[model samples]
Target: MDSTRILIGASSAPRDGWLHLDHGATSEVDRRPSTDPSTESVPTGRTQRVEAKGELDRADAASVRVALAEWRRWMAPGGELRFDLPDAGAALAALLDPASSPSACDGAETALRARADGALWTAARIERELESAGFDGSRVRVDGGRLVARAFVATSTSPSNSGMATDPTSSAPDGAARDESNTAPSAASHTAPTVDAPTRVLVWCGGGERERLRDLLATYGRVLTNRSDLELLCVFDGRATTAAAFTEAAGAAFAATLGTAHGLRLGCVALPEDAAGLEALRAAAAIRIAIHDEPLQLACLDLAGHVDPARLARAIGGGITEPANGALDDELVRAASDLHPWFYPVELAGHRVVPGLGSPCTPQYLESRTAHRRQMLVDAVLERVDMRGRRLLDLACNCAYWTSAWARAGASELFGLEGRPEHVAQARLHWSSNDFLPEGAWRFEQGDIANAADWKTIRDHGPFDVTLCAGILYHVRNYEEILRWAVQQTREVLVVDTRVQDGDEVLIDEPGDLRFNAIESTRRKVVPNRARLIAVLEELGLSCEVLDVPFGTALGVDHDDDYAAGRRITIVARKVRSALPSARLGTSSTDLR
Candidate 1:
């Protein structure tokens, strides 16, 4: 990180709110009364020194020290009294002119003694900034009066899902200082944010211009907000900025779309973009998905009409107010869905096929045949599977990521079967390119429910113990015949995973009361079909465990990385009697419902 310093010397009494910045994010100022102790204090003795704390590099801190000292001496009725805060750069140019605000008073001894004790407020600010930068001063000696810090900045060159510096200190007022070295005279009281050179800069811009503003805001707020990662909504303008910002956008969109769009305002911050925004966003870093290249694009949209409950729901639940610029078509948009909700709390090392959950058990989808449904399907399968485990299968696999993982895991066997030969080819290309296919473990074959007879690729493997069949259920036109056929092929476990919707809310308490609503033909879009899927493996005498859970799919809402509001389930059935009439499993398409 480069550092530079700028010093400003002022020789006048500090102006009231003089430190409040007016640089236009073109937004209103944060006039909301601060809850800080300084805000409540009554000014008493004229303080000698001044201090600013936030995530800033070395040059920035030095620059501030020089500026503050010069300002203090210039304002000095007898000595410099006012101080200037530095920007993110020039923190290292701390050489304040000694003549200005020189510690020459007899009272210097007392001030020095008092400073040695450290004021709570100022120390807290410095401490917070240091911690956020991944530096804990607990190990550093405080008497030396230096706040040490460490931090990491993100670097990604992806086209859609791009990122910038993550370190907070690079933009803070100064490098961490024990702060007492520059604390105001102990007897003096402070006021609201010092009305001098602004200690914090809030950069705001609308639409695409948000990217630049975001970096500026990120630099300052990281420490000012006492967070390593600031959740964008922290407003330097307080409420007026966001309120007026959203109000304008809302009125504009509503007036333009009127009632035709059904829902004009799309999405709300759910949480305010205040200090609270910083808190809420910090936890979701793992899955903190950015929909647009610019994080600010969602800023207004998130805070829009959030106060209005009915409006809020309509915006989020309705269709995409504006189609995502398919730029994210590849990145962020995993598999294909906007928000993949595949991660769930299922034991992977030893997961059981729960009864009545629908089709396949614990095994999950790795990649999508289509980028559109990729995230949603990956999210669903991940929800069903545990986080651990190096070995996996991509049965009926489209992308073959499961086989790739097993090969990567150096598994004994990683089998991938796709109904389409082209898909198998694509899967092979991917696994091979990634160097994930092991010498003997990974295998890909072209096999479909209509015709596995000629699908010789899988024949060499023989009757395998475990297999994954996902998305094939609803696509299987011959639902019954396919079920029996799939059963005969499996020796130990047949994972019959598929989509099932509760067509009626009249819950059937008895498992035997289950009935197939309808069967999907060979050529049909299964996503929107208003029918429930039922596994017909019972005739094969397999002990069928039906899981009625519906994971999010192409037909459903974007799945959160955490499984929520999905309708996909997995079924693990054991083949008890392969003796079920083999003639019954022939090519003749049979409808189960």
Candidate 2:
């Protein structure tokens, strides 16, 4: 049997080692014998690969079905098909864009309307058609205003060959021959052939000094030039007293700083103080900011409150720099003062907090503890999970140290729930000073974990991709409830860091507050044995594993003695096989600090 490689809708001259087919009357490949299954009989199960370009969009629904069926029939077991078609959605979007010229808009409209019988060929529609045509799996994505798709024929012999063509002569769309030695393509490569750049939406509220705004814009403009994928949307609060003036000043600042280079990717809007308007803005925004104005900060918070907590994760409270006059108001000054000292020494804007009078531990101790715990979590759990676009929940998030760390690590949305209002304020201050995330992508809420009502509020914000119950489980009297809540809220993984007893018995100490007292009430500490903790987590449908602690000397710094003695352990619990996808359970190693 001859191995066939077919290229349909070839607009150019045919290359060696492949068969080319086209229906165009003036095409160079028109001289070849017709392989149209409808008109002429073609051998089935002989083709190793098939690539079609610009043919599907010109076919009606019935014709598309027939063509797909014929192509799949021709494909051998473990064969593949790749194709590209005009993206109807992209065409429509191009027509809708106000920046598009009249001629360009007309051309897009004409191309879309010219489709066979006014039929539209979208990526999603093509995927469905491919699936119906008996392909084992199919994927479609928009690329340069066109839909590129790949489909595979299923094989029952070996799982390795399930979605890969065996023939060595099979070539990619770019005419490169396939390497027969390579393993099957990864699921991600097939499912998400193209990875679109993540958009960072920046919502700036309240006007600043024109010079200050210009300086800020100048800094951002330089950053934007290098990051074409990042978009900047400056939404000035229309409710502010200086709304019109601020807007005008901002426009001038943008022009002076960025000029025409970033005009297409940057936009400034002044939205009215209506709920509908705010809601619309929130729907499109990934971050929100209020700069140097306490009233504006409060207003931004109020606006953020209306959004679903799960959706409103990232927010910035103030501008990056402190005011020159040094006459900061009460709330701003207090938040900046580190009113509720952070248990972990969180560094923001190149400044690390010094251990103040009420600090529980020395700066060295805090740094060592934070580094050790963070390294353990990353190696045992975080490395396994894809944090790029995942939602994260940080319980008892004092000063949001872990929350801020995860945000920088690439968690798209972050919700840090802490019992202390002062810590929440400090968390806001930390983000404001750093200006690391876009506003509306992170939020620090004050909520008591022990309260069921607070749990209800947290539930509304979930189900989270990852939940961190660090240093709080052992502190709370209701350890079981906390575990259950953490497990219930988490969809993929739950990380617990707590003091564990060496003995089998679960011990409950007398009501006491630790040196780093962030809890509101003096609750008895419930320390469970390692086995009990693992068993409970297993019962909650999680596969739990204790993370290994680095040797005392290997830690590079003096960490707490409890970790070296195995009294304090970090447990990474992932949902059982039945609960999560098998792919997510794959073991991966990450470097330790």
lDDT of 2 by residue, 411-468 (tens): 8888888887777877777787675578887788888886656787678788899898
Worst 10 residues of 2 by lDDT: 310-319
Each candidate: how many clashes? 68, 11
Candidate 1: tens digits of C-alpha lDDT, residues 1-593: 00011111122223333332121111233311212113221122232222223312223333433433333332212211211112121111111112213333222222112111121112223323333432211111111123322111112111211111122222212122112211211111222322221221112323312222332222222222222121222222233345345433333322221112122112222222444544343322211212221222222122221122222112121111112221212221211111111212111112111111111111111111122233333444344433232334455576564434334434355677766554565455455534554555567776655454533445456455545666555444445555554555556656655544545422121111111111112332232122333324655667765544343332112231112334444566666764444465543433221
Question: Local error of candidate 2 at 584, Å?
Answer: 28
TM-score, every prediction:
0.33, 0.40
Q: Could you tell me the TM-score of candidate 2? A: 0.40
| Alpha-carbon shift of residue 259 in model 2 (angstroms) | 47
lDDT of 1 at 212: 27
Model 2 bad stretches (over 4 Å): 1-334, 338-340, 504-515, 518-522, 553-561, 577-593
